[model samples]
Target: CHYCTFVTVPGKLRRAGHGMFLSPDEVLAIAREGAAMGCKEALFTLGDRPEDRWPEAREWLEAEGYDDTLAYVRAMAIRVLEETGLLPHLNPGVMTWTDLQRLKPVAPSMGMMLETTATRLWSEPGGPHHGSPDKEPAVRLRVLEDAGRSNVPFTTGILIGIGESYEERADSLFELRKTARAYHGIQEVIVQNFRAKPDTAMRGMPDAELEELAAAIAVARHILGPSARI
Candidate 1:
């Protein structure tokens, strides 16, 4: 996305710097280390389907005998649960019902950031999420609903001050409340503040003030009621 701040290593940056995927053994070793340190959750945060965009990613997946990045994630999650003291918490983006079903048993909980429900963000080429299909409000919302339908505990929330209005923020919270009421599968709502980062498209933008986040939290609590955690 245009507002993203993830660091990228170009193909020529280092020797054979196309990219690399961690092995299942490597994953298990890290999980073991975390377990030894008394960490309760192994949070797996990854880009969705890098194989679709990079030839090197595709080649690596094929050579590794995995169909896709998500498949590898599931495998690693299973390994972590079976071999370590940590519960695997996945943040793989935009999962379908089948994806949720396949991951539920191995992954106790997973997350996808609702970000914002404002359709306007996807309408302009310069918008933060204009090029990110998974960031679309409808697609993200469907993942939340599917997680509910599939009985997978989910974590979702909005990123304040990303060009969305207060009305849109309220709308997004209402949508989350609707999903939580329908299936009782949502476990957490993160009221995150967006900070400007250098080299990002939104670097020049102002950081989200604490007051805005407080407003959102208050609205979230009011909409989701006392039972929901803000």
Candidate 2:
């Protein structure tokens, strides 16, 4: 439904609501609605920022007294899922070792896909999220190493087309592969196409073509080796 909401024709059915940002009761209600439709596994993606793409939406929630931090979001997710007996049906993204430890027991083996948006998007010298790749790599390695200590399986992916070059894409894959080699936990790679959403700096920019995405995936598979999945 989330997919259809965005990609549908004429934008006839938009996913506009405060429910997506706040209101645990509303979120739980939607989860129940999904379950009733035979969705055995409910997958809810909690965005890293409330308004990283839609600042107005995020601000609205803040005005209404919503906690926008990842920690609060995770706690709310766990709360609603448990309250409605949907805990077994939930899967949340863990960004760091601390988050992994916190959510693993609640949603064991849940995906902890390492986020790399800043790595690529911020590569430009003046990019808003800019940080050195040199520093980025160590953070990634620590995430992988900590995932190993937890004795749990996981999956990871990358956000592409953030004004990064093809070489940078390949380099990102190489770094991910290096981490996977040491941890042996990362099992899948999702190469996400960046969307130029409203209220974001990248709005109106073209999204990546299918061929570019395929090529990147192919290169990623090669870099990750035959044993590792991409």
Residue clash pairs of candidate 2: none
**Most accurate candidate by TM-score:** 1
Best by lDDT: 1
lDDT of each: 0.86, 0.58
Tell me how far the alpha carbon of residue 55 in candidate 2 is from the true structure, in angstroms, after superposition.
16
What local lDDT score does residue 168 receive in model 1, on the 0 to 100 scale?
Answer: 90
- Candidate 2 global CA lDDT score: 0.58
The C-alpha stretches of model 2 lying farther than 4 A from their native spots are 1-21, 47-96, 112-125, 131-141, 226-229
Error of 1 at 125 (Å): 2.3
Error of 2 at 200 (Å): 1.9
Q: Cα RMSD for candidate 1? A: 1.8
Q: TM-scores, in order shown? A: 0.93, 0.65
Model 2 lDDT tens row, 69-162: 5545566657656665554422343256676776666554455444353453445555534543322544655666677667556666766666
**Candidate 1 ranges beyond 4 A from true positions:** 7-19
Q: After superposition, how far is residue 191 of candidate 1 from its true place, in Å?
A: 0.9
Candidate 2 TM-score over all chains jointly: 0.65
